[model samples]
Target: MKLFPYKPRRYQEEIVQTIFDCLKDRKHLIMEAPAGSGKTICALVACLSFVSENDKGIIYLTRTNSQQKQAIQELKRIAEKLDLKAVSIQGRTNTCLLIDAIPSLKEKNMSNEDVARLCAARKKRSLEAMRGKEEWNRCIFFENFLLIKNELKFDRVVAAEELVEYGRKYKICAYEMNKMLAKKADIIIAPYIYIFDEFLREKFSMLYS
Candidate 1:
């Protein structure tokens, strides 16, 4: 059966077929695909296939916004073909609601006490401000996300480390959920983190879990 709505490139077809076979046999697939290959599409198709009968959906982990968008777009097209549904996740601030969308100016002027005060308002407003309707079929906003994030009110200082720490604490809440889904997902397309992180063997054994 054609796994996706769009025709697959030759390599994409091969990867999809292999992934399909592995999933059917209940075996793990660890591959290294070079750039310019349609790996994202291949993974999405397999995940869609699995989700048809299983409660689990696909998770894709991508480090960059552009890469994540590609997976999302590919999934949108394939979902139409297979009549499937999928969702992408990101941090609260990443969404349109500006859940944590702290502009530079306002943040600069704010004192410690002011920051504390605004954090709650920001989280609550960020949630209440957004539309409940599923306006964008390709992406879905996770409700209660801001509330959950604000509940902790992280106190980190540095920029990159702040995000890194956030990722560590809220392993569930993603900087962008695509990378999580991609690396650990049933059919994921992610970076080197999957293979390089040694602690994963002892900590998160299941790549997707």
Candidate 2:
């Protein structure tokens, strides 16, 4: 496939074929390979091949935030050869700017749900303020977002950290930006909690499913 991006390493073609076959047959696959065996790229090529023709999406789950980097790098290479848009998603606890800026929110050690609730309220107020209701406090980061949202693009593979830094520079909420990007992503790279947690998984599924 054009998405492979490089000549196959030893057994790499076999790995790709096995995965493609499993996906085509609607069966489960378990692949065990040594480190540096091109497994990551193999899986990307195989899945992209299927999804490109089938009009589907891919959700690549990693154990930790760090593990997402390698998969994103490999996916970037494949994207150069094929048309694709991808996003690395992270939770609000890592990407919310208000929590860091407000002492009370930061000192309380809020859970993810708490952070989500606060963010939702702030966003609601931001919208309400935009619609001429000036009674509620607005999230400044989201205010900045309204200024820059039209200029934003996610045509390439965007790692979560890189997006976060971009949001920092623009003074927008990275987590909210991620949600907007997720709506258009062909492949989504996220941590396991996105699948293991029922609430988050439902939200994630609604984005790309």
Candidate 3:
């Protein structure tokens, strides 16, 4: 895969290479670099190079949607440079927004004719897809998110409530992966609670509960 030419400053190169080496060795890394150190790019380089194909796609969690978008954008920039495809998994509501542009409301405002027309158009296009594609789940999650945002805008097609319904299905927890990856995640990104705060751990327990 191609890589970005934005050379790491004199110091970050070591950190980047160290991260790459640690991941190659399957060692857990908890690195902290100051601003302008290309943390995002370095992380992607390590993740893209080292992650196994059979493992779950890179999971990047953040407190705010903006940070998640920032990470996704940086990964995309690196991917474009390297010609590697990336994935992003988010809340289900966001997924619903991807399915349709308009969030559904209990009250109907638009004409029934227009709603029928939109549904018909989507069905027609949906059928145009390649045969056997319906059974395949090939699109990367993050790529799917981008398509919903850029191509469709997610407001008209997805119902907000339905999106909320799938929130629990995609969450990642350390305890869950401990039996699998020993708490190691490919490009794992989440809040501090999952790491330092026991309360956060218990909250996630309830989520599983």
Candidate 4:
């Protein structure tokens, strides 16, 4: 699929082929490549190729935002060679505008669960207030999200920066948009905690499975 700009090294090509073979055989692969080995690009190209061939999706679990950015960048490069849709998601704490705007939550050093609870409480209040109103005054971002969700597209790679910019431009919650996008994204990039943390793992499994 002309996955890379330059010719791949023998080892990189081997890794790519091995990944494809493992996927085809329905086997698991554990690979460790040292820094400067272009492991990121190799994995992206190989797995993306597999996904396109099989009409499946890839959930890329990374450790940090920097790693997510790296993966997204490589995916962007690969998108030039193939039609791909990808999205990078961070924890709600990093992407939630409502929680960020609440001083009390910040002062209390609220946990993620706490922040979620408080945010839900606020949203509930807004929803109740708008029960009889002609206009909506809830979280505008979330409101806009619901309004435009049916028209949302997921046919191109969407990095965190672009995701945030889109939400800001449309007044939609970036965090919510990411969740919705994940359902249709060919590649879903997220922190390891999303798949490792007990509570979140179960929740996301239910949502995506």
**Superior by lDDT: candidate 1 or candidate 2:** 2
Which pairs in model 2 have colliding backbones?
A: none
Report the alpha-carbon TM-score of model 2 versus the true structure.
0.93
- lDDT tens per residue, model 4, 1-209: 37774678768888888888898899999988788898888878888878788888899988878888999888887888887778887766777766555575566777788767755765665566557654343576666676778887654878766777777676778887777777778889988988878999997887666
Distance from true location, Cα of 47 in model 3, Å: 1.8
- In candidate 2, what are the lDDT values of residues 1-209, reduced to their tens digit? 56788888789888999999999999999889898898889988999999998999998999977679989988889888988989888888989888878898899999988988888889899988888888466698987888788888765888888878888887887887887887788999999988999988898788656
Local accuracy by lDDT, each model: 0.50, 0.86, 0.44, 0.77
lDDT of 3 by residue, 16-126 (tens): 678778866779888887876777777766666556433544544567655655665676566455544333333222333223333452234444345434434544444
lDDT: the better of candidates 1 and 3: 1
TM-score of each candidate? 0.50, 0.93, 0.44, 0.86
Badly placed stretches (over 4 Å) of model 3 are: 52-57, 95-209
Alpha carbon lDDT of residue 125, candidate 2? 94
Candidate 4 residue pairs that clash: none
Evaluation by TM-score, superior candidate among 3 and 4: 4
At residue 76, candidate 4 shows an lDDT of 81
lDDT of 3 at 146: 29
